[model samples]
Target: TITEICDRYPARIVDVGPKVAIIEMVGTESVLEEFIEEVRPTGIVEMIRTGVVSMGRGTRIHDTNFINRRALADAAAKADSGNGRIV
Candidate 1:
């Protein structure tokens, strides 16, 4: 059923586990709502929605400071989340 929804809409099943499936989707608000309706019966325990973050029309998105990852190793991820690698 999820595969059918993905085929019919602009969405991707990013990850699935024993108890959860993460679907990343992009569409107009109404379209997303429709997709949710299609999948709602599967029981949605959690959901995360992405929102637009705009710096402005012509502004360039800034990149973080250059860090030589080889020098930092595991410390980089640990610093980022206060835990090990996220996934």
Candidate 2:
């Protein structure tokens, strides 16, 4: 199972359980669609996507967006105090 996924696509296993496996493949949209088609026969229970994260070719730093560490910590603390809700 793992070998087939690895051979067909450069996917990283996120989690594995008795009935499902979550994987992530970082690549072009076409490649991602093709991989989905290839894996359709194996039963996909659910899929979640965070949208495209992109950068110019040959750039120095990754083009990821992130909250400041302190801001994140503050939000987390608020959520914890608010019973895990982000309000």
Candidate 3:
């Protein structure tokens, strides 16, 4: 049960779509097994399983667009550091 899994573990809710959410877990591997057990009988139309290859912690910037634009600008500024680029 996705709801039960959400209730049992610490997770982050990703906006996958209007009807679906990607529940990212931050707990032991055992919790994932439990989640599978709960969801199997729900008759939901779609479900996916994946393993986390790597993980990182900490906060993300609140203003994502602004941060992205700044990052792109910084990258552009450095692109011509050695052999100057035109326009």
Candidate 4:
């Protein structure tokens, strides 16, 4: 279902782990916000707005390490118990 939802937008799922995923979507801030809202209800325990790449120059303009380790751990636990879905 997550894959289906992402396919509706200009998004690429870059990577996926047991409890986390890296998704790259090309859009404006508003579009990003809308995407977040769209995916929030799909059992996504945590999401980190990792960075943005400039479309014109293909350069990263912003980056951050804003990950929530506790949430990720919790999500992992839930997935291990079949109570969560990795997004």
**What is the lDDT, from 0 to 100, of the residue 76 in candidate 3?**
80
Model 4 per-residue lDDT tens digits across residues 26-62: 7778888888889887676756675675553323323
Per-model TM against the reference: 0.57, 0.54, 0.38, 0.47
User: Which has the higher lDDT value, candidate number 1 or candidate number 4?
Assistant: 1
Q: Give lDDT tens digits, candidate 1, residues 1-87.
A: 777887789999899887777888988889889998998998888888786544533323232333345437657766778655643
Winning model by lDDT: 2
Question: Which ten-residue region of model 3 has the weakest summed lDDT?
Answer: 55-64
- Please provide, for model 3 over 1-87, each residue's C-alpha lDDT reduced to its tens digit, 9 standing for 90 to 100: 466557766755565566666666655679767765665575446566565677545555555687789877877887777466634
- lDDT of each model, Cα atoms only? 0.76, 0.77, 0.64, 0.73
Candidates sorted on lDDT, descending: 2, 1, 4, 3
Ranking by TM-score: 1, 2, 4, 3
Model 4's TM-score against the true structure:
0.47
Worst 10 residues of 1 by lDDT: 57-66
Residue-level lDDT of model 2, residues 27-64, one tens digit each, is 87788888888888888888876678775665434534
Off by over 4 Å in 2: 55-87
Model 3 misses residue 13 by how many Å? 2.0
The runs of at least 3 residues in candidate 1 whose Cα sits more than 4 Å from the true structure, single-residue gaps closed, are 55-87
Provide the global lDDT of candidate 2 against the true structure.
0.77
The candidate scoring highest on TM-score is: 1
Compute the lDDT of residue 5 as modeled in candidate 2. 69
